[model samples]
Target chain A: MKKLSLAEHSVRELNSALHDPQAMDGGTEWYVSDPDGRHALACGLNDELQVTIDGHAGYYCAGMNQHATVVVNGTVGVGVAENMMSGLVRVRGNASQSAGATGHGGLLVIEGNASARCGISMKGIDIVVGGDVGHMSAFMGQAGRLVVCGDAGEAFGDSIYEARLYVRGQVESLGADCIEKPMRDEHREELRGLLAHAGMDFDPSEFRRYGSARELYNFHVDNAGIEQGDSHE
Target chain B: MCGIVGLYLKDPSLEPRLGELFEPMLLAMADRGPDSAGFAIYGDEVPSDQLKFTLQSAEPGYDWEGLVTAMERDLGGQLDWFRNATAVVIKTDSGEERVREWLAGNAPAVSLMSVGHSIEILKGVGHPRLVADRFSLSGMQGSHIIGHTRMATESAVSMEGSHPFTTGLDLCLVHNGSLSNHNRLRLELERQGMTFETENDSEVAAAYLTWKLREGETLTQALESAIQDLDGFYTFTIGTRDGFAVLRDPIACKPAVLAETDAYVAMASEYRALARLPGISGARVWEPEPGRVYVWENAQQASEETGT
Candidate 1:
């Protein structure tokens, strides 16, 4: 594996190297040391490569990723794996807001808590948070699946559409149009497979599902406010 | 865009190195804001009822020598004064109203920065590094410090427009986002007899908190009121006599991260500003939740006061 120390190299150089597959032809792999919490590290990657960040990262780490398996051994700042298209991005520690926002594909596994707006406006990404997520998570998310192993913050799944939310813990509140739905066998199987993939021991039976009630998709003159919701749980 | 960084030392052993550690935290945000920079250092308690006030003037031709001696003679109090670049610190046991009347009646051109038992605010219009050097912020020692680097949105790039806005004793606020309801709120606050230093929305935010706290609201309670009354996407760190606090708007569009360890409680616009701090690797790092207040008081002082 290739080794680059952020202390000696700028974050730009690391990203440039990752973008070009030829520079990584030896193995398409890199081990980044001493990240020291820099922003936009390993961003805009589109190749099938293995990149390991050994320490903490700052904003937008591995953002806009495509077909890259990026791993961080320490905590991540805002928007880790934001707008990813494919492959896997995992954080060993906590993540900040907007993780996997507007992402079209791929899987984001955060072993620790993610702050507000995790999986916000998500398109097709699969997100698994091992700990609590802050408020407004999955806001207006159109597609994909979000599985939370711990409690969720206020207004969870606000104004969501299509995306499936599976939480094994308490949800503080639901947002406009979001509602608790019966956990069917299909969703349980999907969530179970995801837990197995993340190497977590969890019982699918302990999880509940939430989604859009589909009442306010279009302007129904009856629904004339922002506090609209039909949550059962 | 704006950048804010704060360091509140939980360990007394790190008190002397406050400025040394805070400089890099402020400078790392050079990209977030390049127009101006500022910091509020809380230290050197007066050990009495006397209050310290930091004042500044933009006119290089302004006379600090004439102003200090004349102000002393005018007030006829035991005034202690000194100069640091364009800033002056005046300490007196006199009341704030008396000093205010004196400044208005005497040095109209000079602007007041802060008034507190221990806090000293120094700010200017320049790059973060240059501003820090110009004000000599690298050598000061304090128990806790709050700073800002500003990219102007609603105000000009003057020293007055720079952040770490202080309106109350031992109270200052640095903001990372704009407020949409500032004009209305400013007018409402003005009706309440609160004067403003600049047209900056952040000043309104600071003043609002100051007003709330002055009316017997705790820092957390005042921030809770802000979450309801203020309309915008903002992340604010407020410096107080006891400690500092972090808060964000309910929507939480603006970015803010906080990390706390046994040694310190630090907050920054991004994790990069906090990466270099001691023991941050093992710190309990997380984003300040939307509409929630996270406050860290000096451990030793709190324990002493509580007799714990």
Candidate 2:
């Protein structure tokens, strides 16, 4: 595995040098150093590359990526893997807002808490946050799977379209049009698979599922009775 | 795809710090819209009651100077100075709308916009430094400023299309997202005898809000009306002479994030954009509710002054 240290180079230089396939012989590994907490360290990559940042990073660290498996050993800034088409991004520490935003396809796993608007407007990304998520998580989410192991803040999944939210811990409340659905046998298996993908050991049965009931999507005068939704037992 | 930023403060204590905080925020958004940038800084003068008109005209051949001189003679103000290719800061002893009307009649060819305690606008095409140099942005002392960098997707690439556009006295708008119902609104405003300079949706929004506000409606009412009336993806950071307001479309098609500290209130299209500004470490940041409009007045202004 080849190791590429990003400490010495600017983001633009590092990206330009890494864009060529010949420079990266099969399956390259880069160990970034002296990161000094720079933003957009490894953004806009589509190569089959394995890049790791040694320290914390600023916003959109691996945004709009494809066919890359990027890892941040420390905290990550906002929009991690934003609009990523495919591949994987793992953050060992907390992530900021709009993580995996508008991603068409990808597996984003954050080991720590995520800030507000996490996975917002997410299209087809599968995000697994190990810790609590801030308010408005998955707001206006179109299509994706967001699994939160810890507590979720208020207004989760507001105006959400088709994304599925699975929370193993407490949820403050669900946003408009979002409802808690029973974790039936099929959902349990699905959760188990997603958890395994993120290398999580949590039991699937312990988690609850939340989704849009499709009730508020089509507005009705009588629908006023359906205010907010909760998923705690 | 560049950045836009604004600052409005009533406390004179924070006035000097406005440029210091705003410069970095504008730098952060360089990647979003790097083409051209400018800012309209508004300031309150000590014991002052004067209407200031900062007008930017097209290239010199358009006869804007003659019109400005006539309007200045008519409105009873002196032309402070002319800078670069466009900006002319004028001071008038007359009322705000009176100056506006005089400028409208005399400078029919010039696209006039304003910001601050009275009204001022600074804009040009190119990088921030390029536009800043053209307008001498750093020297303007104001209580607040609203700025924009153009990506030119929906609007023509010209000085008139730049942001911080004014609809009436002391009102300006800097927008990040596109307005869906801009065409309909523009036609409606034009029918009401309002002139539009550019095809950009943001201009229509500026005109719409200004028209609504001038008609005795509050900022909140104009925003609520925008939510009910405006269509498509948009997020606007609007600054008036008195305060600033932010509004997102009901669906929130565009992105906008806000952070508020006890000392200051800041907002931007992205969190990364705001991170570049000072005093963000302890600030509590969050996305505004979709379909909701949030208005933040100058920290020193009363709640009633917000006109929300």
Question: How high is the DockQ of candidate 1?
Answer: 0.66
Candidate 1: deviation at residue A153, Å? 2.8
lDDT of 2 by residue, A64-139 (tens): 9998889987667678999999999999877867889898898999998887788999898999999888778999
Please provide, for model 1 over B1-308, each residue's C-alpha lDDT reduced to its tens digit, 9 standing for 90 to 100: 88999999888889889999999999999889999999999987775679898999989778988988887877787888888888988889887888988898898988989999989999999999998997788787989999999999888999999989988889999999999999999999999888897899999999999899888987767777888889987999988876888888877788888888988889999888998898888898877667776766655322111000
User: Which candidate number has the best lDDT?
Assistant: 1
lDDT of 2 by residue, B1-308 (tens): 54666666545666677777677666666677877676777774412665566666666565556765677667564444354457666665666667667766766666666633455677777777677666655555667677777787787777777776777767788887777688888999998878777788888888888878877888878887777777777778877766777776654556666667666667776665565545555565555655566776656432222211
Return the TM-score for each candidate structure: 0.92, 0.69
Q: Where is model 1 more than 4 Å wrong at Cα?
A: A216-233, B300-308
